[model samples]
Target chain A: MNDIYLDNNATTKCDPLVVEAMLPFFTEQFGNPSSLHSFGNKVGLALKNARKSVQKLIGAEHDSEIIFTSCGSESDSTAIMSALKAQPNRTEIITTVVEHPAVLNLCEYLETEGYTIHKLKVDGKGNLDMDEYKSLLSDNVAIVSVMWANNETGTIFPVEEMAELADEAGVVFHTDAVQAVGKLPIDLENSAIHMLSISGHKLHAPKGVGVLYLKRGVRFRPLLRGGHQERGRRAGTENVASIVGLGVAAELALQNMEHENTVVKAMRDRLQEGILAAVPNAFVTGNPDNRLPNTANIAFEYIEGEAILLLMNKMGIAASSGSACTSGSLEPSHVMKAMGIPYTAAHGTVRFSLSRYNTMEEVERVIEAVPPIVAKLRKLSPYWGESGPVENPEQAFAPVYA
Target chain B: MWDYSETVKEHFYNPKNAGAIEEANAVGDVGSISCGDALRLTLKVEPETEIILDAGFQTFGCGSAIASSSALTEMVKGKTLDEALKISNQDIADFLDGLPPEKMHCSVMGREALQAAVANYRGEEWVDDHEEGALVCKCFAIDEVMIRDTIRENNLSSVQDVTNYTKAGGGCSSCHEGIENILMEEMQARGETFMPGAIQKKKAKPAAQPLVTLETPEPAAAPAAGGMSAFQRYKKIEEVIEKVRPNLQADRGDCELLDIDGKNIYVSLVGACSGCQMAAMTVGGIQQKMIEALGEFVKIIPVDKAQYAAQLAQKQATASA
Candidate 1:
């Protein structure tokens, strides 16, 4: 069986069209965009066109506002550090508890460096408490870095409204829109969002490429200082091939966003419905409708996420769990913890993020393979004391087990 | 990502005896939820023969722990009581084609669950000297008799010696006092009584004598350092060393009492400790502090590189000529 991948939020396989667009940069159009030769000008014009494409996707007024970085984490670090540099006197930062570690860890490092940070709490539904957010906002606040949508929970935040509030408070607003862009419509022209971060690998583009949207009048210091690359904003040799790939991906996503909302969501909902019906003690872990249409996180009580992943690996079904990182710390996710999920349930969190390429047939196949695996782990789990078996372990596999 | 043997994965995926027997003649539960793993086992016996009729298990743990418990259930299903009671953790792992070294504790859990289940069947309870034995460290499934035997055999003379040998007093300091009490009792029983104030005399003198000999001389002079005034520092050092000796014996190594001025310990690493990279980590991480805490008056030292290199060179020159 070909493995079914449902971790698009973690990283995505590059689309074939994006790969095709990147080929010329590797073979025929290889040149330093900043060089004086004609070959350099040709590639430089290609880079310019790619920048224009990315600018159109986010609805940026000028192409010069976009700065390409290595990845979303780099973008986050650059934005936060630059904001602090721009307003050194303002030593306060306000962010939500559910921000990705890329933003959260940087915020923590900043706090240790004398920046006062206020982490707004999240409700059980994983939505940030806006009242506390408003209460914490002041002129001393340097920046409010909120994610457009949670990578783990997929709970969409009100970034526009928050940006407007930050504008009124004279605080810079940045959103890590790595999960939102390409899947959702982003109209930066109408919003007060001064800085936004988006990654390529998140939207079926190549890895090692990301875009940071800085408004034309925004003043920020450079995180990577060396050469005058990215017009002296970001310093690094251009990842020409991957940038081309990201440009194509952004164009495809702009064309496919509406269809993803409708078609992809239907498949995601069907998969969620089937999983809920087939397995006991399994429930979705985010806001049902407010979540990204392509994403669903579920917690299976009494069983750990690693054990479930082990079982899923046997059946050639690929998914991600929030239990253990490569570091082997068995701590539950901070995102889940911020939502007040108990460690037992929190460690069992598994994320299933679909893509435009995912199908209803694959969803059905997942539903067919999941019940027995969950049942087996539940039997050995001590949390659910002797609850017998789930309602039907053999429903999906009557012939084999019987 | 581990290169698990196919058989190990098979047993883990489809463990033979997994579930609970509705009406069981025996039941046992080991570990608690806070420790992150537990096992509940149930067994049924044939009325006439007392042979295990069926065995089933429920484990709240990682895959290996559950699989080990399930393996134990299968190992004892058809055995008589005495035969089943003799099964060790190694037996479970050997049956499952050898487990990873770190996961040996899983097999230990398997052995504990089976024993606990059988004891539950026979309605046996923990006792001071009931022969069936008492739980050693509830966190790691160690027992009292095992600790005593390890201490006596290894010649471990301190609380740290017992920890290195039996992994007791390794977690949650709540249990270290129990280990200390057990060590004291065992030492007293062996005619090595506690002493106070011998530490001041030892500090005053500058000769190298065996620490165990110094500790065993008198009980009154040793325990002068604290509210428990009879526990002498040198005596505690001897007690810890005596316990650790037999443990080193299992691996063909030996522990020696050290004498140093700036520090309380300075011992030669004769065999296995001479070359191992983790020798210092093992010593500094566990042994050094354990010995220091129990025996405050003596400094401990493993042989440094300069001394070890000279010894190696002398041996090499002797061999070459």
Candidate 2:
């Protein structure tokens, strides 16, 4: 059986060209960039060129602004903590309730340490409340951190405008753009975003490499303080090969940016439209217009997501879910919960995130495979009846054991 | 991915008795969609011998849950109600060559549904005895009696084991303290003196205090050493901050207690601490010390100079009003 992978948001397959660019760094060109030798000069020059490539991909004004880290979480942690360290008198953090766990969990931890956290709410369509977000921006706020796009629902946030507002307030702003980096068009030179984070793995680069872009003149405190690296903004010996791979991936992403918006998006829409038409009572979860081009989150009501995923797995079709059972948590995804999605729909949400490598045939194969799985699982569900699904899905399936 | 047993996979793929019996005499349904799993079990019993003539189940859950329900129907058929009642969650698991530890709750769900079916057969309400006890794990709606009973029956040793067996402390884990309390109580009943932390030791001290009433006031007086009046907790909180002061001072920082309102410990960081990024760590250290010296009820509020001044002025206004 052929594997049809649609879980690209989880991680993308490393491009072979990126692998070819990185192979020489492992054994042949293996030299520490900080070493004062001819070998070091070659590696150091490669690092500089790679930085420029990444800088161009995101439209950053200068290459020096990009600080490479191990992963997206590290970049997120460094950015948020740096803002707090830069302005210690400010004990408040403004963020969204639907942010990835990297930002949400850290903010929660800070809350326990006496920092007041204002988690802005989201509407049913997964759009942030700008009025509430503006109201929370006070002089005491150290930073306003929000994700450029939601990982689960793929809903793009209005970070450009939000960042400008924060800039006007003289407050630091950071965005975890891990999902948005290669999927959307970002012009950091034109935006007021003080910092942005990107994971290499999200854009066909190898894992264990990330980039934190801090605008020059933005006061930053290093999370990892040691011998000067990332121009003293970050520390540790650079991941040479992975960084090279990330650079090549970034360049490739920039080259294929239009294809992603055109061909890849068409495939995503076809799969989404096909699933919705074939599967009854199914609907898309996020905003139809303001979403990532290569992503779609669709909810198949009444049945649980894990069952659907297992049936899909049997057919060698890969996907992901926001269901509580899928995560082994009592509640579904925080993004779904923040949007106030009904439990019936929330428990059955499936996310199909595509990449540049995915073909129309693969999307068609998944569309053909998913409807039957949903229909089969819905048949097994007690809440689903012969006439139709029960009204008030929550109370209709109340616990009979207790 | 789950490493399900071959038996489990077979039963899941080809579930036996996968639908409801139309003329079923007794029906027992358990769990819910919100709980991430649910089962509807129907049984047809022979009126003369009281033997289970047929069993059918409709399950809405994961692979393990469906397999467990399928395995359950196969295990209960052709057995008397008394014999079916003797079938533990372990038996259902054993029939399927055992389930993953984390999926043990699926088997437990099957067992509970069976018990409910038997109760329905006997014309009795499936009144769960465990529900009467105080609720402990709010995330899973698990109660104290359920935690205690599962701990004793399964020989559960830690919170993780309790979670695997009953899913109690499996969610947000705010009820870990309550679960630990029940664990300690059960362990003490078994003549096991070992406890998890100093909080249990503190709890054990109160139980041993009735023997020496005169000595009780002396030890209690130490916690409230400065005075036994309204400001005693405040003075103690200040003392705890004094302990953490040197660590902060080493980093060119310092902390001062601004005010104490109820359990809230209002404090302000000064000098390098005022703009230090590690201020969260410094405040956390002070909060930990306060919890150790005072109690868990202390809520530390780190304020800046302006916020501290506003709070002080507000306190004065409220006092006058």
Candidate 3:
């Protein structure tokens, strides 16, 4: 375990209670839900209960609305692929550039197969361009898949409004709510979103399990086809243990949503403010007023993000970076590039995502450790002089990339 | 998360020469904030002997970049300007116990900084730009010459290898075809061929001839500091051989370095490489690396392992007499 972990957006620690709930399913109660025997019937009853737990957590009208998949990526792929397969005539997709690669990469692949993919741009604050988004919507579009909260910046898109607009255009809407499922209050029963995706691991459940909340009346097609599991909506024998763990995690998420918005959010805000106060040429990198309560992306100009992350790791702090080096590319993130963030700050962005388990003490330790590391790196920066931080990186070093 | 070596980690934590020298006579800076890594290398050269007295570095990059810069500064100190110019990016990686392939570009950055610093001391012009129509990977702004040089230096066989060393085709991947053409061109020039999905399939024309018209030949008068000089060209063969040594060793194969005479290099492929069919590819790769290293092409003269051993014994006897 790290002394301080601020990478909840990547993955969270599995809750012990959720692990305990999964243990029985893995050991003694390992019968297949498909069998007609008493052992199978008992497991089927547990499966139904887990589905109901997920339904209550997301405020779905029926337990059957939640279809279990392997992970968030699988859920996202199913949602987007099902929408396009359900309607063959609509050969276009409308999405945002700031979407997680699960959606963006799929859309790009679909483009090669003759589907017109319109990727909406984002502003400097990581907010989607609403006018372009509105203009791109049409009956020709099969689906509009945008992330509810960006995994990198935590900037929440107006997915609800977009979903309603897509609905009016006679299109299915899917939002990759992998980051927003537990942190925010979601009422899928009363929402216009045709489908929503969730990952169990993001909310302190075991990995390899996810929920695809398909509205009761929405037309659907399964991405996987093997067994009659999930009412022929999804396939393969269920990941029974992980599904049980996910159910407990969902219940816990419902219980902790209030604490997440207040306590965890306060710690995140303090860590953001403290780092900014001590470091120069640094600023938050999202729609600060309307983002996830737990995520804060801070960019410090001139110095690169990977260096900062390594130094912080040395100090027993775990975090993440938006730099290209982290992603095994020669350029920064697609989200940072799409936002047109200045070159100086874009490559230097660091993301800190908090969980309800984090505390003010860990936040304070991070605040104290960051300032000195930044100063030390600045002193070693070629672009940084004794005076002020580098204002324009492009001027000092030519030939930059997006 | 990056599988960095202990030496790299030590250098990152306690970088030997981490700051700038106020009155340094020679200074060379490469990369920019926009490029995601930058380095400013300062050197104090002893004027009459042209020997480096001291060195310092300020690097803005990842941990490996910092470690590479630190290793470069240490390696160059006390060496003459001529000797310093011979240090390849591979030498920097070797000094720090080798870097991951993905982080190999950091060592390349260090080599560029050293060249700039040496050129600065000699009052020669150094460049950061490519000529018009020379850019290959536009997203990273890496040009054709740099890509070719890196492919040769690292024995890179694919677009992914090129990106790992020089970051040329690691962008939007539009230039992947351009890089593949270059790879094919370089491979054919050395007579090495593979048949991975028609990648190494021979064309009807002279195989050595470039298949694509997109690549512009390296300019006759290459940029002073940015381009390879005679020393760098001469050193490249040894570096190329050294770079492939471990891979050969891994398979219980090896090569004995004997002599270099103009366009012909004499070597005895030993161990598993002695009479193996795949050694043909290794020989082709060595020649290909040299062809790109120096603008002119070279060939390898395969001396049998037994014959070379006899020749070495005869030479030793003659020296004693």
Candidate 4:
């Protein structure tokens, strides 16, 4: 039984190269970067090189612009809070409704703290409403935070153009690029995005390391204030080993960028097309042309996502669902709801996020395993058969059950 | 991932009695697609004996929910209508070994469907009295009566417990305060006080028990004497601090215990908590929690940094003398 992991959007397996690069930092290079001794200076230089590697991956102008934090959520918090604190008189924020909980939850907390939050709505294809977004931007708005690409549906938002709009209004624009940093080409040095957040684990790096890129001359305030670490922008001792791993992962991501665009995209499309062709009443959720190269969210009607995922798990194929039951909420994914997906289809949406490690053979295995599972679950569904009273179980049951 | 029991996995993977019964005397359907779980239960009854001749169910839900409906059907087969009505949600869960607390609502759905089916069999209107109660959790459309009954039936004690039993405050959490209010009212009506932070304290106690017992004489013996030892008091104070630390940390603040003299606890507020306007609330809430967990005489004093430094100096001076 082969184990096929397709839930890369949640987290990916760490690359061996990244782990090999980090091994020495845990034992041989154990000195704190803050110390004045030679041992510390050696570790400090390695940290500098790691920053440069990440800077090159994202096309940042200076290595000093990258502030390392604990994870993506911390970077997001720092960027949004710093923007708001820098402009105290501006008590309004503009964001979209389909943002990950890291941004949406903070926006909700800020709303209670007397900041007016304007949640831009999305269309049926999960595209942001640019007109509504533009109308909400003004002198009173302090910051505009949005994701570069959604984690669930893989819909890419126009952060580059939106940042330009924000800059014209003198507002700080930030993007949670956790999903887009490694998969897509980013040229932040030429873009107007004032701040961006990236997580290490989303790529092949280990967890517990993240980067917050602040363009030079951007007003900033630290979320954690104590030691003068990360140039007083973030306060915590460096997660030395994880940071080194992230740097190596960034370099690897840059090297494989083209392969990701072509091969991984092809495998993702194969899985999506095969599932759609085999199953009836199945369709992709996001915009096909503008989505991330490694994602495909397909909805199978008249069934639930959790059941589909469990049956797929039986086949050793791991995936994620946008169903409300799976999320521990009674409503489906906010991304699906924002797109106005009907209840029947939204309850049955499954997300298949590929990675550079995925192969065509693994994709083919998943494609072959999904149709029978969907058919079996739908056979048990009361809503599945042609629009009338269900047939008698006595007639439908096989001899073994009868 | 959910820690589903083996029984639940078995029932979900190879569910029994999954199809609809033809010429069924009674059919009951509950839940909607939007609610994330729904069930349709059908029963073939032996009219002369008033016993359920057979049962079948079709469920659209997660593994635990589907398993729960399947378990309900097996439990009710061959039982009289009255006997089947006595099959509570807990019985269904117990039949499946047990369910994660969050998935207990799936068992509740199964029980509700059973009641609806029984009502249909008796030719009686299944009155949804839930609509009469004020809507408490707007996200799940759960009303106050449903929360109250589940609380009473299960002896639930906290907002999280209520959520696990009824799924009332699980989404958005805008209605958590309302759920808390209902829980307090229910507890009070039953002549019990629902301490605000008791549930979390209870959850933490088991993990800390071995260490506490190893150091102290015995925590079990403290309640008998109304006066706790210094070590026991220290352990309790640490527990209280751990309980409030996350709330403080979320606001980028922290707290530390400076000293404890008898019933009074001196604490220092650090980070963002030092000059916060809600410093009083933070201190008062900690004091309330200590009093609730320890005893009524417990008090907390928020000592400033200068005062703490002076007290330390005075202690050193006394030691030298």
Candidate 5:
């Protein structure tokens, strides 16, 4: 049996159809899309069709609004940079605490460049503080880049409503929908969002391809300045094959949205319930009410995450951890820490992010395997059955930060 | 994934003498949940000889930490408390072949647990005594003495090296400047020139968010190493690599040093060697000769051409930014 991979939030295997669609671009149709030759015209036409496919997936009005880039990081950086450059008078940037490194690192760099970066806090359940988000939106705010859905917990933020608020404030809003693009329904035609980021690999497309949905008439600047590719909005040679692959993957994502919402979500819930039911001191980390269908971030208290992952690896189960030991930076995930997850469980958080590829059989295998693994690791832990871990996990962190 | 050695995996999977010893006379505990790893080591000590009759441990940490604790328990049996105290963090790692540099803190936790247990047996108050110097790294509970000792012992050049060895500057990194001063102090004491801007230059990627809070800050179970300083080894490696370079340069190839971990020598092939079909063979030949000339078992890990280029580009971007 192959390893039961539940780390789709990291990256997904490319759909065979997507790979097949990409192959022609690498060989016969390999031409610079920007060139004025017949070879270039054919490639350019293919790129336009791919952009249209992406446009339909995101429910955008025009295909011209879609700008293909290398990956999600570049798309996010470009969108934020464009917004900031378009409005130099507004030096303030508002973002969330639990953003992926793509957004957070860029904001950090911007902060060093004398930008006032207001990183808004989240609730104990990993929900954004709406009141704070409302209060922070003001005339001086240059751009507000909030992720549509968190990569870790899959907690889908209310970006639509946030975008409405930003629009009312006359601010340029960008949602990093890298995790949400294909999974959730997005209608940029009706929404007030100026820009959104999407990564191909997050949804059965190959890596090294991404899309930035720029709302029409939004002032922008190119992140990479070279060739007039991506309609002069983005520079450099287009990644022809991956861009074609991304288009097909985007279409497949739309088709598989139903299965993702039902079957995959069912498996995720089963895995979450199965682990929480069997393992003592285990609890779900984020808000379960409005979360993505695929992610189940459960914190198994009293034991560390890396040990559990190692044991699970032996059983052909692949998952990720939020433990400080697992992260090379020697800190538990900033998301979990931000949610104020207790120290005992914080060090032992396991993230099982599912995909349409996962099955109930694989889910069962995980359920059957995880409990014993946690039990074994807990035996070695001094905190287990001791006064170390709090009985009520929610009460772990007493003083809630404002 | 952490490239844990076979011995570490064995010790971690089938831990020895886990759990509290009821008849144990002395007990030592270090680290806390906040720090992500902790150990409570119990020892049955003979009063007359101060020898450990039996040793057991209950560790709350990652694989390497548990394995280190298990290995520590196995190693301390029938050995005097003083003798066990002499067993440094590096010694535990040596027993387990060698742990990944990231997991070195696990071995350090083991050594500290031993010290705490021994101090407990000798009727000494060590838990408080361990916090002797001014606190340098608040997030990791790393004191000035601990940072200085680690820098002096390891001959650490930069804050990153300090982090790898003692986990002093791994956290929020607000104390990197504090660690930098210690590194500067220790390096100058040895008459070695230290790059003062090394720590300050490698800025933290992003500051911690408003939501994330350090609720509990734990102690520094992290200890220093015992060996020929990294500076001395770096010079020896440079001299050794220079010996092997002429042969490679003759073939229109060259290697650039990336990093020098204890047994792991990271280098990137440049010139003709970058995409040569016989690059691995060349690397192997160089490794064999360098080991003989340097009189040390060093694995020369060649960073792939693509990765080397990406790293160089990122470094340039950072410098230019």
Candidate 6:
């Protein structure tokens, strides 16, 4: 009955356990982690345990590989820049078209700074073209930064395969796992990924803290030069509380991985399935089976996403779209556009990212509430009148049913 | 967001008089569904006296379009042609308590529909024969009389000039030409067109001097009865710009005095400033600093990229001097 949050992709509520882990560092254990005092040692120990938890979550071989930064963006920036700095002799970087702006924008800046950039494309369902991705990797390419999951579509990428290809090409591989971590299982030991970025806020931890998992024996350079914190890799006073929260959340996520994969995926499937059954023209976006279990992106033809979002807000449901951001901009979603989704359907797309806390009752509520709203909006849409509301319940049910 | 007024939203959701008449004597159609907004107005006219018997509309657009059409229907339901002809865009906006300035064109559209309907009822041939007489904003097909009445009622003096005028450039951007034509015509009618466009360009450009002394008369006091609220400051700026227009024309220089903040009035130095070295001095020192000092609510911003070019010209002139 309370506001149903479907925008888990944007951010998540901090879990109570994570909050409890963070409480002491804010006051009782508020010592400069670097200072030579018992107080500092006590907090320093907490930081170590947090790092260990993060390391264990990703199955990293060493705790030293877990480097903490302010957020996912900073982690991504550090990874890309540090790789290029370590290999200054190389001037080329390869990445995919569907990367987050944190990587894409930085890549744009790098291109302007004389770095040759290669962007791989995605298919109509937002799956990256691995054949093209393989061809683009070469000796001159110093770094490869691809997202483990597309933020808008929740399409999981072949990071392991890509990492293997990059390794053969002598390139440093990095995946922005901001949307993938916790939602999917990640085992660095079994994967060729040399570096991966994860943010606290995407899971159930507070913002302003993130982790960059850099494999041992990897050469890198630090972005900022000041303190000895983060093993001389990053030089800033630690966000002790948020870091603690992120560690606790990561540990909890590791513990819940199995249950979440099944339970959360079921809820996602139920909601996506129900909407397609009720609404006339609803279709899920991205690779239907390969996507994150908690994400469901659907396009209800003929209605604008902002209008749907507004109406959903009235009904206490929160969802997002790629369209509203595109209207005033020439740059549509690099992910959607690369997939060649027609502009009409691209603008009407809505993304629903669920969290583990979401329940079947909430899924049922959404199934009950969403169709009529879509029907109402369709009445006001010019597109709907032209197509005539996709009549015949059999025709409406055929895609999902068949 | 379009900065929509509450009135616009209300009428959009619960339009007062929607739908069409079964046997309508006259109909007015404005805009298209694909153009972002449209209104189809229908009215039954009493043939003997040419008074509207009933009025209704169906609009496909934003809240402002729906509201404007709804207000138009209400305004002309039982009025004669002359009375309805006098219904300006502002009257519809006022009827709905007010629309955002950019959306004033929606009201203009509504008025256009009513006028077109009445014109159609009175014989479209008659209205067409008096093309110049009707005084239309050729771009949006808005009439001259409505613009004059809007200015008088709104105490407007400038063409940045638009607020709540319908049928003007709201979408698709093609109607902008007509709006500009209407604006020039309005200025000409007010005897404000001393030397427009190339006429001023034909005058020889004066070489820039170090001490470019400007003679600006203190702006005339605005009509106090209209209230000196910050909202009305734009009208006062309009008056000041008009007074300064003649001097700018005679000097063969193009300058725009923009009201950035109600308190700051900025005069951008153009022409020679286009290539002047003192462009920053003109923008920061002369324009911005001066404008901010003018009114408590005013802040001036100079868009002149040619400030340095003007300074270089002035420096050359000073060396010659």
Ranking by lDDT: 4, 2, 3, 5, 1, 6
- Retained true contacts (fraction), each candidate: 0.22, 0.54, 0.50, 0.44, 0.49, 0.00
Candidate 1 lDDT, B61-143, residue by residue in tens = 55666677778888898998778988977677777766654455667667777777667677786222223345556544566
Model 6 alpha-carbon miss at residue A63, Å: 0.9
Please provide TM-scores, in order, for all candidate models, with all chains considered together. Answer: 0.68, 0.76, 0.78, 0.78, 0.76, 0.65
Highest-DockQ candidate? 2
Candidate models: Cα lDDT each: 0.76, 0.84, 0.83, 0.85, 0.83, 0.72
lDDT string for model 1 (A192-302, tens) is 999999999999899999999998888799999999999999988899999989989999999999988999999988988999898877788867769898988998876
- Candidate 1: where are CA atoms >4 Å away? A324-327, A383-402, B1-3, B21-38, B41-55, B71-321
DockQ values, each candidate: 0.11, 0.27, 0.25, 0.20, 0.22, 0.04
Task: State residue B100's C-alpha deviation in candidate 1, in Å.
Answer: 7.1
DockQ score of candidate 2?
0.27
Assess candidate 3 and give its lDDT. 0.83
What ranges in model 5 sit over 4 Å off?
A: A386-402, B127-321
Candidate 3 lDDT, A1-402, residue by residue in tens: 458989999999999999999999878898998999987888888888889889988899989889999999999899989989999999999988888888888888789679999999888898888889889888899999999999998999988898888888888999999999999998887779999999999999998999899998898989998889999999899988899889899999999999999999999999999999999889999899989999999998878899899999989999999887786666788888888887667888999999988989999999999999888888888778786755565466442211
* Cα RMSD for predicted model 4: 13.2
CAPRI docking class of candidate 5: incorrect
Q: Which ten contiguous residues of candidate 1 chain B have the minimum total lDDT? A: B197-206
Question: What TM-score number comes out for model 5?
Answer: 0.76
Worst 10 residues of 5 chain A by lDDT: A393-402
lDDT of 4 by residue, A1-402 (tens): 669999999999999999999999989899999999988988998899899999999999999999998899999999999988888999998999999999999999889689999999998989988999989999999999999999998999999999999999899999999999889999999999999999999999999999999999999988999999999998889999999999999999999999999999999999999999988889999788799999999988868899899999989999999998788667788889889997778989999999998899999999999999988777667666654324652233211100
Candidate 6 local Cα displacement, residue A286, angstroms: 1.2
What is the alpha-carbon interface RMSD for each candidate? 11.5, 2.8, 4.3, 9.0, 7.1, 13.2
DockQ value for model 1: 0.11
Which interface RMSD does candidate 5 score? 7.1
The single-chain TM-score for chain B of candidate 6 is: 0.44
